[model samples]
Target: MLYSPFLVTLTLLTLLTASARAQQSGPVVATPQRPPVTEQDRTEAQKFVAEHHPELASLLSQLQKSRPAEFERALRELVPQTQAIQRSKERSPARYESQLAAWKIDSQIRVLMARWSRKQDPETETKVRELIAHRQQLRREQTQAEKQRLTEQLQKIDEQLQNLDQPETQRIQAEWEQLSRRATIAAKQATKQKTNTTGEKKTTAKKSSDQQPAAAQPSPGSR
Candidate 1:
């Protein structure tokens, strides 16, 4: 059907968008769990989903007309997708476990992309963006331990330069430039997989805030 791809894309984007907007609260998931599917459960879910499916079909038009970011959180949680459904194969349990696994992976990738785009927290995002900007500044054989050693050296130089009567600013700057560029390269390859027309890199960041049970938030100033 002409609507199939649109539906799938809408549902996936909704699920991911909701996850990013949510502010995580307390100690929650050991691991996310799904309840076992009963026949009544399957019937109710299927009927409701089929009836409301057109809401999702209309999402893109709605998105274009509204502030998608603001509305995304409320919409994502309520939309049901095949990944969380309880369907019978010949009136038995799911016969498509592999499909389930693949669906999860696809959802995860999309969510990470949403997380990066929003720049929800600049401190964390700067780290992500810096990595993206500086990718390809290094070689493949480098190890984590090696990188740390270089970073430490630059840090010491940074500190010494701070205390200087006449700072060896040029020397310190050169050293930092070398290690930072390499780290930047490695970070980019590890993250970005696609690019938008705006030339911004796209990636997914998912959170199952609904499927994931929310931990109770602490009262303000009550640590």
Candidate 2:
């Protein structure tokens, strides 16, 4: 993760907005979210592998038969390719940019809702209520200029929220989802490799164990 504040805010708001929509139906559907991997990322990653590491594409079957060293070497080579894909872009696709803006505004609505849910300080409650009401009024404005002004206001709010030491819970949750997904995938891959290796070792050990008894028995007549 590159800690570009602007990209962080943009990505956080994007996921937050999606989560809010899901929440409206009932409970929020909590899926592990990864950082926005655009089509460009996939394309470039495939291209890199095909161009630089064509053999890796077929490593799965080969790894089963090859030495563990070969598998480790392949994984080592993939790390830089993965990093290049991840660092390729700091922003989402252009088609998603407008959606991000809309989601940014929706996330503020969620912020207000979360504050209200806490029901803690009366002062904070009143302030949040006022912000919600103001946002609703902005939504009702008929003029294009008024809408643009509202968008600007929302953008400023997003920037301010991004700067806070403790980010809004929604943003934190969204980031966690991204990190969790990445971790989960890596963990699953490691577990799978371990299982396969363990299975292979067990099979080899069993064969050796079975052969030992037969060898010790010698010829039938010797027994």
Candidate 3:
């Protein structure tokens, strides 16, 4: 199985970084100001939206006319993902499809988050949680798939080492060791990040529940 190094590295870095905690936190209510979107960015975003997500294209069109700031923020968020998808398609078609599926889920989650931000209702919050859970499952699937591919690669490398001289064997062993170390670190980091995310989510949920007055709280079946 083929894998894009850039995409792999990007994913690993995201999982390994301290910022991953913030990235995985509760829905951001405020859209942070980004640098102005250039004409080139808008054009590329339009092209990408038209090709991959017609719904987003319609949303973008409406935003452009009614909310220019939102239009820029959406475009800024989209263009990088669009570029990443394009690169994935070029490097690995199977991986591209997987990434695209995740991206679609991400898009849905974003839409739900926006709705929740505007009005913190139970139905929208429930949908957002469902999508987040689905996205996490997809990430697990991707990680498992990558692990299988790496196992196959290691097996091939071992076979090759058996036929090679001592010098070549040493070089292959070094390469294999490096790959093993990286995989080990990535696995550890991912596990830690997931634990933190779950804890944060529980904390956030508790706070949200506590903030609501008991008199105004809906029944369990109401959701």
Candidate 4:
């Protein structure tokens, strides 16, 4: 049957729309990836860690365990796992970003937990375990719930810092400023007060030593 040109054009357009919809229903679009961390970026991140959280300097300085390197490894390792979510996202792009955000959140939590892991105290160790357990819950959470919980955890940490003394306050603030910038901020914070104490002792010693000779001097009556 002969068809009008307008009818033929309309038919082609209709077929294209159906094909596009079918593709949408069968596979989620893979997201454009963020650039992976570079060696220079790693070095900068390392320097940032040193300036902001130097205690991790040694552990991270090994060149093998740096945050950039570790994060790069984690992103690579998470690839297969993200792929597993492909089937679930097949229905919509909305789900894809949601899944990605959840994955990112999970990764961030792990990074945070690792930083908190070097504590030598048993009580802190127990709290770390509890923090980890809640993180696992965060992973399983719905998007809205996870975000709310994330906010709550962050605020709780902030409140804990508020309750701490000035030295603790400074440490927590410094570390938070470099969440992804360092891997050892917490460890550095833990030693901050002690380090300040050492500084105080050195100043006190100098003052005492400076006075010692004068105090030991011969009096005016001494020949």
Candidate 5:
């Protein structure tokens, strides 16, 4: 229930990826395929965590010992750190361009993988597949304008998919919403518990200090 910023970001990214995959229309392929997470990708992630968030390496254990309030505080502290790290990485021109290219290809492959996984309803699935095939075809066009047109078309498709109301789409949306709500609620409860615990500890210490002074006072006769 103690969700760190890194965990939260990773979860959001995964959900967004799934949502992106679901919006496409595609025929079910025999084999599900996705772009492999290359060694370079792994290395980059590890390096980033090691250099920027060494505390994250022990985050799980820390969370276990932390009160809900402390956990929430930690998450709040981590958000800006995580953002700063991402911004720093993105500022590197060479790395930014390379990551951008890799992301686009990975996104396309993930869409295909989602289709193969049957994430879409049959009707929606077919439509997404058609759109994907069309995009692929457009990629072969040898002009910058043509490539730009392809981008426009893809964006239009994405917009349409977002607007499309269907039982399956609603179901997926509801599930994600529920997950987000649960995480929020858990964090709130943890914060409240931690606050109460801290208050009690303070009161107990005060009482103990007051009793100690009284006990140390000499009896009236001895004084």
Candidate 6:
């Protein structure tokens, strides 16, 4: 199967993200049971696939009717990663672009695997391997990028540490103290108000009870 250059790029980006995560977490462990996928998750997954991989959209729909289990599994895989990619787009566009391709590749690979599982064939296996290799290359690139990012961040942190004794530090410290004191005051006021409100409610309730007419006394020979 011919892969679009765009798909190839996206697949690599996803692999890079995965590599970075795996490095941080160390060895992979058994996955814990995931929460049941919701309708909202399915919708989001569908939207994501529709946008990134239009071809897979129909496949997903078909899976839902003919292979419900496979459809759910596909959703479970797609939702969280797609959500993360969406967040990255909002928080960091460059990062989003870097990871987007990788995500696409990963999603495509999953779909392929699902298909292959049902009916294994040499052609499908070859495509899977090719995609996997493409994704790994992306992972390596992503890891390098992550390292570079971390290096830059560390440099910034070091510069900040070196400038710790600057006059701005004192100003910042004073501001922090002022904020903390204000927060303390606000919290105390809130607590006091809540306590007063509760006491007032109790007092009002007691007064209403006191003002109530007493129950009528039983007649002496009513029994």
| Best model number under TM-score | 6
TM-score of each: 0.21, 0.22, 0.53, 0.24, 0.23, 0.54
* Model 4, position 48: C-alpha lDDT score: 40
- lDDT of each residue in 76-157, candidate 3, tens digit only: 6666667878899999999999998887777666545654654689998999799889989999999999999999999999
Q: Which stretches of candidate 4 lie over 4 Å from their true place?
A: 1-76, 82-90, 120-223
Using TM-score as the yardstick, the better of models 3 and 5 is 3
What ranking of all candidate models by TM-score puts the best one first? 6, 3, 4, 5, 2, 1
Between candidates 1 and 2, which one is better according to lDDT?
2
Instruction: Tell me the lDDT of model 6 at 18.
Output: 48
Q: What is the lDDT of residue 161 in candidate 4?
A: 78
Distance from true position, residue 186, model 3, in Å? 46
TM-score, cand. 1: 0.21
- Candidate 2, poorest ten consecutive residues by summed lDDT: 1-10
lDDT of 4 at 172: 81
lDDT of 2: 0.51
Error of 5 at 68 (Å): 65
Write the residue-wise lDDT of candidate 1 on 40-90 in tens digits.
654454354344354433443354245445333323333334524335233
State model 3's lDDT.
0.70
lDDT of 2 by residue, 1-223 (tens): 1223333332233333344355345665575644554556545544554554343333322442444444333334333435543443344343243333333344444444444444467776777577567655544542465578789999999987766656589778888899999999999999999999999999999999987854444778877
- The Cα RMSD in angstroms, rounded to one decimal, for candidate 5 relative to the true structure is 24.3
Q: Give the per-residue lDDT digits (tens) of candidate 6, residues 107-128.
A: 6776576556556899989999
Residue 123, candidate 2: Cα error in Å is: 85
